[model samples]
Target: MVGFEMNDRRKIGIGLTGFGVLFTFLGIIFFFDKGLLAMGNILFVAGVMLTIGMKSTVSFFLKPRNYKGSILFGAGFCLVIFGWAVVGMIIEAYGFILLFSGFWPTVVVFLYRVPVLGRLLQQPFLMSFFDRFTRTERRVPV
Candidate 1:
């Protein structure tokens, strides 16, 4: 049963990656077409979400500690919606960085489980940085 699930996930990831590549190609070919380019970007983001496994990706955003990350993300979206051009892109990049930081623990766990690359996940500095988010402070009752 688990094997079947893993196989399904792999198939989905491959399909999404292929579709993303196709969209990217079409975007390049139709560079003059703004609509197509935008669609390609959307598809590329979708592809990444799928490749990372939707459950894990969604969970990252849904985590309580990561809620603040949404504020930056939303601000970025608003900037883009207002058509701020380059400024919006810059803000969006920062937003993504914050969002990723908020969920770095999940990312670390995933990376640590990988084969060859897993060894790199053991670095003290990296663990310490990511662990900052995983820590919770306790308050004493008066």
Candidate 2:
């Protein structure tokens, strides 16, 4: 039988990720407070690692196709640490989009299963937009 399990580790990971997002939002609201932003960044990375495990996290960031995003993300973190919160967050946002672009479709699929949000997201216009985005290939010519 097909099944899914919600283990403790996964639950903790999800909680951490949610907190990371909250802290990041608060940082922006607080005029890009460096301390909050740094904490957010740390929590976000830790959440991802815990969510996927160390091996998977390393492989994901180290993959040749993801090198650009990985590098930018790392640089952004460094910038944040060095007190350039605004610029670092901007760079991190771009890097985040690049890194998680492939996950959009999966996330959309999951969203479609939700009760309230599903109806909103399933509208033809929204679905079309998401479909177009997910269909575009992001390959680099060797």
Candidate 3:
């Protein structure tokens, strides 16, 4: 879809740069000069928000609101946001160990789209088999 001007772009941006914020924040807290640190912190957070905006922008191409594909795109958007929020919450409540544990799964579910292989693997029997094998690790492509 080429008409997209919003939505998925926001997601792509958000998905790609979250860790950058971590680095920027750490830099500000540890090494940057005080005034520079404050600016860096603000820039880092702004980058976070802009990344989301980019996701929404790019997603529009993948799922134009006026088209039928929009339904799936919108659903994907909701799920992506929800999954990340839950992951972030888990990390906040726990610590880095839990953070990494929670984070990678979401990252994979969002990024790993194997097309034909994914559909074939989605069969009911195959799904259950992998569900048990994978330990209910994820719902997206599992």
**Residue by residue across 7-105, what tens digits does model 2's lDDT show?**
787678878888988998999999999999999988889888887778989999999999999988998989998999999999988898889988886
C-alpha lDDT of residue 34 in model 1: 39
For model 3 the local lDDT of residue 22 reads 58
* Candidate 3 local lDDT, 1-142, one digit each (tens): 4663567745654544555455435644664334333333345335545654556535543443324433433343333234433333233224323223434544444433578777877788766655554454574343
RMSD to truth, every model:
8.5, 5.6, 13.1
Candidate 3 has a TM-score of 0.28
Using all chains and alpha carbons, the TM-scores for the candidates as numbered come to: 0.43, 0.86, 0.28
- The full ranking of all candidates by lDDT, starting with the best, is 2, 1, 3
Flag regions of model 3 displaced more than 4 Å.
Answer: 1-32, 54-104, 108-135, 138-142
- TM-score (C-alpha) between model 1 and the true structure: 0.43
lDDT of 2 at 105: 69
Q: State which candidate has the highest TM-score.
A: 2
lDDT comparison, 2 vs 3, better candidate: 2
**Cα deviation in Å at residue 56, candidate 2?**
0.8
